[model samples]
Target: MNYLLRLLTILFLTNLSASANVITLQSTQDSLAKYSIPELIGKAEVTKDSVYLNYLEKKDLSTEELANVLYMHGNILINEGIMDRSRQYFERLDSVAKILKDPFYQFVSKLSIGEVYYRQKNYPASKESFESAHPFVAQFPEGIQRALAKAEYVYFYYLNGQFERYSKELEGIKKELIDLGEQGKVGDEDLDYLEMSKATVSVYLTKAYLMNEDFSKAEEELKYSDKILKERFHNKITTTAVQQKLTKGEFYFFKKDFKMAIPYFQEVNKLGDSENFGDFQYVARVMASIAYFQLADYKQSLSFSEAAMNHPIPIADYIDYEVEAMRYAYLASKELGLSDKAMQYSQKFLEQDEALKDTKRSNFINSILNNMEVSQLENDLIAKTKSNYVLRYSLIGLAILIVILVLFTVYQIRENKHNKEKIREFMHNLEESDKAEKAKQEERRISKANAEINSDTPAQPDDKTVKILDKLEEFESSDLYTDSKMSLSYLASYLGTNTITLSKIINTYKEMNFNDYINGLRIRFIIEKIKNEPKFEQYKISYLAEVSGFSSHSIFSKAFKKSTGVTPSQFLDFLKEDTR
Candidate 1:
């Protein structure tokens, strides 16, 4: 019985190993037979190079098949962060495709080369490669491939900071997609690819808008992309989701909401890891480092910054993020008193910054700068004339009135000179009397302080009064005054004191009644909020009043005027002027 059982186990083990071999063989054959070059390249983006290469080497292939394999290999190397080796594969494929007269493959190879250049921050070379492929890609029939090529061009434009060109190209591609659908050329499968491409393009556009600080438009594009991705690609669209999260994180980062930005960046890193989104993963790490640094979590900031810096993949094209990571790492190390690490990171940061300064001297950036300069000049001219037609007309009429008034002013100046001397004499006499009155007031204030100090029995606070004052200070520090419904009774209960004591303390220390004290705190809080958050200036008077704990706009306006010697609107205007 033992011998029989041993034989059965051996047979089972043998069969299991045989079955695994068969499955592996079948997978290799299926990959070689079933996938197109483009599909294989897409697969290379997510799969391990070893697995892809194992299958790719198993099959005997034709020249075209060899070219496709080479392309996939190059893409795998790129994913593995081996750029020099990847470029060799791409160059070989380009040559093979040209010899084979495969325009599609040729265009794809050129685009790949351009992507390599882009990743290297060689913008001129990247632009040249992309331009060389454009005509070849355009010669293809209107289909998913053509649309994808056009979208790639738009992405290139965006990366180069040609936002106007990116916008125009995106609109043109969108119109072309609509036209394609209207012509009934888009079958169901074609529709799927088209929608995916559109969604991908929208994600890029969202990032572009974010970089330009157009938050509303960025949000619109993100929503649009997410909708299409959900309806079509569903959970499979990990890259788009990662891009959306990164853009959203960037938006909040710019808004100085570091707490909000951190979660989005963390989500992007999580998704990127799970989905093997190599590029976005590094970007998310860098952004998380920045957010953590901004939040003053030096340890967390250093962790993320070091992760980004040590990433095998080159994120050099994202020069800003690269410099920021170095800067954050330097700052975190310096804060932690790691002098050696801090000096190392600081040196790296300075080196990268200097390199970036040189890169920024590129014609592409110069063009952008020149365009911005021209835009500013045009804006200034428009502002000088006033954008509104009515305002322009009013200004012109005011100018004519000013000219007439100037003529009258010259004649009046001679007649008024003698009258002005008489008026000045009377004003000087009033000033002297005012100075004497202020001196008397100052003396009276000193006399009161002296009387209080010299009194035989000076008033002193008892234990209960001291306790109440301490609790009142705590209440004020707690921001309870910002609560619209907070009353003397409510605050007194919160502080474990009677309303009478609370009111007495407030009147004695603050020199104001409960209502006046609360209103004063609320007004001060609102002013600080407005100063810190410029967007608060755009709020309506009622909204501002409500947020500042007022029951009504009228009450708020009256209190604000009394406390500030200016109405709320006037105060807001003053804030705006100060900001300018």
Candidate 2:
């Protein structure tokens, strides 16, 4: 048994003694239960699963019989979208199956644990489970059990991004499933499960091909997948049918045909009793949101992304889906001019993304361990040799580094002094030029106003343009633009115009796009304040950034440089020099 599974067995053994109806570990009762776990799982009566579990718990079961109960419980928990509890049952099943030496349960239990991990965004652990189950692949009898296990193993390759390894495993399982069907090896009892397995494999294969950007191959896989579903399901909207629909939507989604992708995804959203659901509903809603976003339909995109966020499971349980959904929700909200909601979604996105990165970091460490673990002695030897090489090079590199640093520091100090002298002179000239520029601007404003009065017309501007320009002058004179939460839509709405019109007017008269125009105004305002207020010189750039509508120090520095050809630090340096 795997160490994790062994640990799970020890953990759950106390549960067996909790019920009065518990069977002794040494009991010699018949191992087979009246209801088959696999069959019950296929029925997927999620609502009535508690009744089934209650009935099973009351029975006197043997060692292998207990495995069946565990498997059923695991399947139920998984269907209910409770991954952590489902994982415990799977681990227990794997432990019991190992003791009984049952190939089918052993394989399925390990793979089920893997599926839980995959859904939990622990792909590295999922990969380990798949690999650990590999030796049991051929041990299963060539029927529904074997086909399902092999199909799962093959699907993991696609999940783990090992598409190059996918073709061989996929082809092998497809042939096995085909042979089982052609030879009539599958019994009526196993037919439905077998069909579903075949359909699942085909659908995901199509997804893999589409993900690979192999549209021709993807279409070929789709044809095969559709044929299987049409023949086996006949529009029944089974799980496999739902998966096939999602695959088709993904095909068009990846092809950049957002319009064509919409109906397929919408159908999936309404498929069966779709209960705010599992991976299927989550994926469908997320992809539909992305498709709508691609088509610039912000309202529809926000609707779908919001629906995905409202999935039955907590957002943390499905980090990948949460990240994507939160990201798009934020973007859609932003595009629709909902700043408050956008900021909330943005914070959620960051939280989910950080969690995702943490999982990735663990996987990265695991990859390193796998690559280095030839043997303990070899690892020790390699570490010693690597450290020795590092130390030997470090001293020489440190000397050279120190010498370069000293020289660079000296050069920088002198360069700084020279730059300060140049900037001091430039600032002196700049102050004179500012007075001249202000006079010129005032003269132009007076000239234009007087010209308009004399001619009884504004210069080249229509009445509406003139009104907007006047409102803009009033807007500029106020500190309302200093709000860092400002956006084009907000400004447009404030101006009592649409974004398109506001943008065009800004671009035409201001000779800049909306953001640049706002930023330009902010930079100019802050510069005048910094020049006039002696206390502002004592403040930090970060504070200045926040007060001036730039979100951060770096952004403020860049904008100040772009507008004035001098960084905030350089300007401050010249100011302090002038003050002294």
Candidate 3:
């Protein structure tokens, strides 16, 4: 009786295991049905938790089902940007396929692992993964899987700049696909997937042809892939379509047909907008901005470049795009006469360039124009347009100039009012500080009296002298020294004091006559301006003198040299050097 009971118990446990395996397998199949293999191939939408849960629930599945489920889980993880976790799933699938003696699954697992590495930009690891899968190609029967594996290998070769190897492998892949079709071994579903593979292969081939300067061949391949995508796939929003547009845009851009390239790049951007296409969107924006810039549409170029720089992805993830965007932004801003913005973008570009200095990617950027080249181009453009600009402005009437003068007067009036408010606030703060200091002094005097002791000290300034000195400091801080027409009487009246007391205080405390003091302040202000405003270095000496409150450039230059041990031009050169 006991032996019979144990036998039944073991049989029941076995059946329960079988039942659980069936349930899990069914769930995995259901999940996969929602997302086909073709959809999973490129930038597919995936819920990581749902896919992973299906994998976890799977139990005692057949070898093929187990491998498929595992591959699906890894592919979902890859799409979700969980690369490390995806690698683990692919590795597990590889091990399982090895154990089951299934070369097809093994090849696919290895290929998926390579794709993960490729997305991470781990070129060496990705290449090794592809190499490992190459040995299993013969074991893979002629079908969609084999075609995909071959396409992936070709793409890897193309990306690594192994164009010769890419060409050889791609020919073999094309011949094999043609033979498969003639053999009638590919059904409707398999043919659909094969078309996707062909489209991808065409994209890589197009890129290779472009890189080799074979424009005619590149265009042929591009049109072929685009037609196949539209006719068969109905121009669906797939990775193949996105890549095709990108390749076309790049083709036209390199050929200097920027207007022709813009539409292609825009199509790519629109497609990638809904998916996290990982650098494709970034490249699209950058290329579009470049095309617009080359077409001399500064506003559109600036807009696109700004969009690229402020993409949702972290800038660090796409440093190359960030650098390119900054370049276009600088160029556009400079052309649009946004001097301050141009300088800011240029500074950012330099900083990003410095960070990439020791990287292999730096060589790629170096292929583009450098800072000096861009600056020279800007200068040349300015020189070429200067006469036209002067002629355009000269056609305007004196009424426009008078209107500008009136506007400037209004601005000056508003600025003076703002400055007066700021001065009032500063004076209030100083009064508070003075009261606190007086409280401390009184406390000390009381302490001395309580101790019945007296000490001799120099007398402090009289109240009137102290008030004048405080007002003078306030006037200087308020930038009233920048007023070329300022006079002692005018300032003293503004301070509610007489000019003689103000002059006496200024001479006694500042140790300089009124004119010398004002000149020193202006010199200091201009030096600070040169340090802060990069555009200031480009100004003429006369303009500098006009803005710095001097009547003549000679006096301004002399005062600047006496105060800072450098002439204005010398100081400007120093600032330029420091920026570089």
Candidate 4:
């Protein structure tokens, strides 16, 4: 009877351990079904806790169960946008995953932690976390977790603005996700979501491409996004109106179609419930103000700016808005000849500048990390030496080193503080110089490219205008335009001509405004680079624009498309066909 009872007890314990591992998977699924599904992200905690409690009541769980629970809890925290707390849970999960001998779980936990930091805009920490997890992912066998990790790796590369890597990873992940969808035989909704995920990745890639001055490719990607969204699941996700509107608004804002951007912001404000409001309303209002400002509607801009300042929103977004709003307020007041109001806003702007005193504090703190690490190593050496050492002189040497180290650290801290002051002063001067240079560049470019008509009859042309025009044409022909940042003022200065003369020559002779003249030169330059240069064939169209002086790929593509009546890619294809 005793032997039979012991056998049954051992069997029961074995079953319990096996059950804990698989049972938590079901618990996670159920919690995610009710909480994360339908995008009820706000109720995640309540639903998650209830599921965990039910699971706990039914079975005695092991260490693996604890780890999985913590991981799930971290997921819930992430959905709530509580990154710091989510990181702590993931760290705990990391330890548990190591003990459970599951490298795959550890990789996922670290990947999630990296994602949280990424969302917080803590790029350094995010990069460290992702890179650290890469080795673990390599060790782990292929599965859903590995696929997700690859997707996340693609995300990190995209965020860091590594366009080439982002492109390759995006293509790789698309094939993998498609294969996974087929293997699982997942239904249309799941496949739709996976495709949407790919579209979102493509959007970020396009953003990087745009920044890199590859506008033709960026437009192509945007069209791809449009195609994906137009399919069965565009706004079909059962998310809240506020959240949906916020995303759509950002999409248009990035595209720089501020006219289309405004309605989405307004929709978010109109439909969003008050109790759930936090940063979204404030952001929408501020963005709407910017859109209005861009359109030169000063009244609406001032109204939106004033409303945003008064909104009881969080401070993270306000640091940027407050500074901008003060400028707007001052400008509008000056326009109305309200000197007192203008003076008040100017004072507020000065105060805003004073508030950013700690901008260099993080850099100083980061510089101390290596010193701290060395100190830690020295302390460990001393502790181990304490048990073995017998020499009084050895002890004295350590004490002397420690005292010297302390003094050196104090001196370095003081020096760093002094240097910070100098750095700030240098930065202030640099900013002023940058502003002056920008003004000069803009003036020169406008003068050369735009036809200036005074309300009175146009002033007589300068006597040296013909010579200046010759110099301008010569400058346009030179390789200097390949600098991309080469401007009319720069060329005028180089040629010893005034910007006005250069401008008059460009407008009169070329019949083009400053931007158009330069852009036309740039486009022609890019065309030559693509056709004559073999090395540049691999270069994206946007890159060609950057090398030739367009600010963004979208602008480059639009201008190119207008000129050729074909997209840059199509133009490239045409070039290739002609060459063949």
What local lDDT does model 3 show for residue 5?
15
Distance (Å) between predicted and true CA of 107, model 1? 1.4
- 1-580 in candidate 4: lDDT tens per residue? 0111111212222321333323322445654434322122112222344355334424445786565566667765654557788788889889888898777567767777777776555667878988887877566445433444565555566555355777777666556656776788555434544565555545544554543335577677676766776674555422222444555665566556779989988866654343233355666776676666656676776677667666634222112445556655554554556667656665675565456332222112111111222112223333434544656467777768978887998897786555545544543654685477467546555554443544354443443774675566577668676665555557667878644456556767667655567766677677667778867777787787788777667667876755545567766654565567
Candidate 3 per-residue lDDT over residues 1-580, each given as its tens digit: 0111111212222222333323322344455545434233211113223444453434445665566567667755664567888889999999999988887667767877876776566767988988898888777555655665566545656656555677667767766766777888777645665566666667767776665557898888888788889898793666667777787888988677888989988877876666545446667888898788877899999998998887623221212566778878888998899977787787777676576552324323222222233534333344435655776778584548888887998897786555545544544654685577567556545654554554454455655665666676677777888887776657778988754456556766666766678888897677668768878889999999999988778667777766655567756665575578
Sort by lDDT, best first: 2, 1, 3, 4
Q: Clash pairs of candidate 4?
A: 213-542, 214-542, 215-553, 447-503, 448-503, 449-513, 449-514
Task: Give a tens-digit lDDT track for model 1, residues 20-113.
Answer: 3233222434545576543443343334345655465566667876776776677667766787887788898899988988876687788778
Error of 1 at 513 (Å): 54
- TM-score computed on alpha carbons, candidate 1: 0.54
TM-score of each: 0.54, 0.55, 0.49, 0.44
- State model 3's lDDT: 0.65
Clashes of each: 0, 0, 0, 7
State which candidate has the highest lDDT: 2
TM-score-better candidate, 1 vs 3: 1
Best-to-worst order by TM-score is: 2, 1, 3, 4
Q: Report how far residue 458 has shifted in candidate 2, in Å.
A: 78
Cα RMSD to native, each candidate? 25.2, 20.9, 25.2, 23.8
In candidate 4, which residue ranges exceed 4 Å CA deviation? 1-69, 72-83, 101-105, 115-123, 138-147, 178-193, 213-216, 219-230, 238-251, 268-286, 297-580
Assess each prediction's global lDDT (C-alpha) against the native. 0.65, 0.67, 0.65, 0.56
Misplaced by over 4 Å in model 1 are 1-48, 54-59, 316-319, 359-580
